[model samples]
Target: MSKVILITGASRGFGKIWAEAFLKRGDRVVATGRNLAAIQDLVNEYGDRVLPIQLDVNDREACFAAVNVAKDHFGRIDVLINNAGYGLFGTVEETSEQEARDQMETNFFGVLWLTQAVLPVMRAQKSGHIIQVSSYLGLITVPVLGIYNASKFAVEGLTETLASEVKAFGINVSLLEPNGYATSWSGDSAFQTESMEIYNPVKEAFQQAASTPGFFGQPEATAEAILKLVDAAQPPLRLLLGAFAYPAVKAAYEERLASFEDWKEVSEAAHGTSIKTGN
Candidate 1:
């Protein structure tokens, strides 16, 4: 059976690539973006297999409306790719109030709302998959992307809870933690805060890291992995994209584990003795 997939940010990057891949494989796609024209090419090329919608996911009501529209148009939604977030480049001290809020609104709240909207639909059908496009930064923070890291971290927590809660309903949730990809994301889709003199070295380091060979994975190669995921009998709750993600995340977790072990005495001290039922 052909699956009906709903993709946000379907105009470009992985969203566009995966949307086209699904259509080419004879699946239907509800392709959405902030601008209608941005997704029109999908409609023109794939014809009835794609439904292009103009949606800004931050609007709470619009998020619900978009889900309804897709459900009404497609009859059922088998997969949802929350792929509509951007990177905010700024250190913690350099980021503005507005910049931080906007990052959460899209990267965090946007995913929350869309997931909420589709929950009922998925529950009714007893099957669906939600794929959140988080980053490896969610697990390990970068100097200049503090706010972006926070947003992905929030998504990480949210989606983990979602996975456990929705499993009984035959719904699967997955997070795509890509290390980096050669997308316009670091180009025009990115937002950079005003530079500060003190953070120049930090900013320079980030730029240099981005230019490193193998830092950014080829986005085209991810289609097979995605296809395999959605087709799996049991899809993972987290899928790390790119060759760089696993080692990076593993090292971060190892460091974190070391800290936890180091603080074991303090942590257990805080707990004190176990409470007695007789008391």
Candidate 2:
């Protein structure tokens, strides 16, 4: 059965690709971005199957209004792809307070607001899917992208808790942990703080590493992965995309587990005399 899929940031990159894919598969799509002009072509190409709406995810009222508009137009929203976020490039010390807050507003709170807005509709229907486009950085960290990592980490926590809360309502929540993709995400779409001389070496290292061949995956492939997840009868709570994501995330968790085991004696000692609890 065709679905009514709502995607934010559908003007370009992975979001655009996903919208196109869903429409091509005969699904109704609500394509939204801050710039309506960017998605006007989709409406022209797909006709009534695509509804282009202007939405700035950071605006709480805008998020709610966008969902209402989508619901009114389509009568229901079967899936929501919360893909409206930008990368913030800077070390923790170099990023300003406002920069950190702005990053969280879009990447974390934006998802929260939109999800809250859609929950009522989904609850009434008794079925829906929410896909959060988080980053692999949510699981692991990079040197200069501290703020971006923090925002995604918060998303990781939010989506996991949400899955448990909404499962009984037939609402499925999933997180997509994608690695660096060959999208505008790191180009004009990225946000950067003022450069500090103390971090020049770190920045240079990252630049060199990013310039390496095949460092980024293609957005089309990521879109295909998302489609597959939506088609599954039982999708996983977390799906990692890109060739590097699986091994990278696995190694990160394994290493952390090893460190925890190494300090088991010390850790237990700290809890000495604590009452034993029943499982």
Candidate 3:
């Protein structure tokens, strides 16, 4: 049976592609964004199957109302993909306190509110999937994008724990980690704070990297991977999409190993166990 899906940030990027893919597969979709006009084409083409909803995830009341509306319209929401987010670019020192808070509010709290709103319905039905769209930076951090990275890292941690918490309720929570997808991430990357005399050259370099097209992973690629993950009989807890994510994760693992070896004695002492017997 085809499922009914509600995707945030459906006006563009991966969410738009995801809405199209789900509709293409004969599933009913509630495509949502702050501006419904952007998804007018989907509504025009798919008519009743693709319902374009105007919503802003950052708004708590709106988030609840949107979930209620989708549930009321579809009878049940088989999948809720939390895809509304943005990027922040700057070193930690250069980023403003307000920008950091805004990043977390949208990226972390927005997902949290949406999940909370939808989970009750899913729990009542005893089945549904919650897909939280994070970034590769969720697992690994890079310089200059500190605040954005921190927000994603918070999502990764929250979703990982939520997956375990919701398992018994017949709800599956998964993290979607896509690396540098050709979305508006780079172009949309906002500088939280104006550069002081401290690091103008470094700031410029960071801006250049943010504007570089070579690092973008195609949005369709992430969209397709998300479709596959959603369709799987047993979806993974974390789906790392795109080429950039894989290598980045691998490198992060290797770095962890190196760090562990360097602090073997301390780690062993902390655990109150000898290194002789391996678990």
Candidate 4:
């Protein structure tokens, strides 16, 4: 069965690829971006199956309007992919408070508001999927990308809670954690303001770390994974999209475990009870 999908940030990168992939599979896609021109080719190729809409996920009214258009056009949205985000490379202190807020607004709250806009329709229909395009950095904090990482970390926790809350409504939430995919997420297109000379050392490190599009994991790879998940009888809560994603997640988990072990005694003492379970 063909699904009706609404994807934000569909102008390029993973969003763009996923829009094309779904359309190719006979799904109707309301492909949205700040600039529809970026995806003009998709509209041209897919015709009616691909509906291009101008949307800035950061804009609340625009987010709601996009959902409204999708619902009106297709009668329902089976999948909503929140793939609009960018990288803010700088230390937390080096980055201004407003910059941090902008990161959260785009990467975290942007999805939140958009999801809120779509939730009522999905709840009434009792079927839908929400895919959040996060990063390996979202799972683990990296130098110079603190603001970017913070936003993703927020998504990680927020989506975890959201999944449980909406499960009863037959709504599934999943995070797309793509390690170092060669997406526009690192280039000038995705780079945020970084004018702090104090961050010069770390800033240079991050610039070198950014991946060029189509070099690492291709956007198509992520699109394929998303399509596969869409057809699965039971989809997982988290989709680790690339090989690089797995290791980074594993390392972060291990580090968290080690840190817990190191603080076990203190934690046990603070809890006012024995924390040991004798076998």
RMSD of each: 1.9, 1.4, 2.6, 2.6
- Give lDDT tens digits, candidate 2, residues 1-279: 999999999999999999999999899999999888888888988999999988889999999999999999999999999999999998899999999999999999999999999999999999999999999999998889999999999999999999999999999999999999999989999989988899999999998988888889988887678889999889999999988888989999999999999999899889877667898
The residue-by-residue lDDT of candidate 3 on 8-45, one tens digit each, is: 99998888898999998899999989888889999898
Q: What is the C-alpha local distance difference test score of each model?
A: 0.92, 0.93, 0.86, 0.84
Q: Please provide, for model 1 over 57-81, each residue's C-alpha lDDT reduced to its tens digit, 9 standing for 90 to 100.
A: 9998999999999999989999999
- Residue-by-residue lDDT tens digits, candidate 4, 1-279: 899999888888888888888888789999888888889898788888888899888889988988998899888999998988888866777778788888889999999999899999899999999888887777887787788888898999999999999999999888888877767787766655656787787767766665445437766767667888888777888888777678777988999999999998888789986657788
Candidate 3 vs. true structure, TM-score: 0.91
Output the better candidate (2/4) by TM-score: 2
Better of 2 and 4 by lDDT: 2
Identify the superior model by lDDT, candidate 1 or candidate 2.
2
* Model 3 C-alpha RMSD to native: 2.6
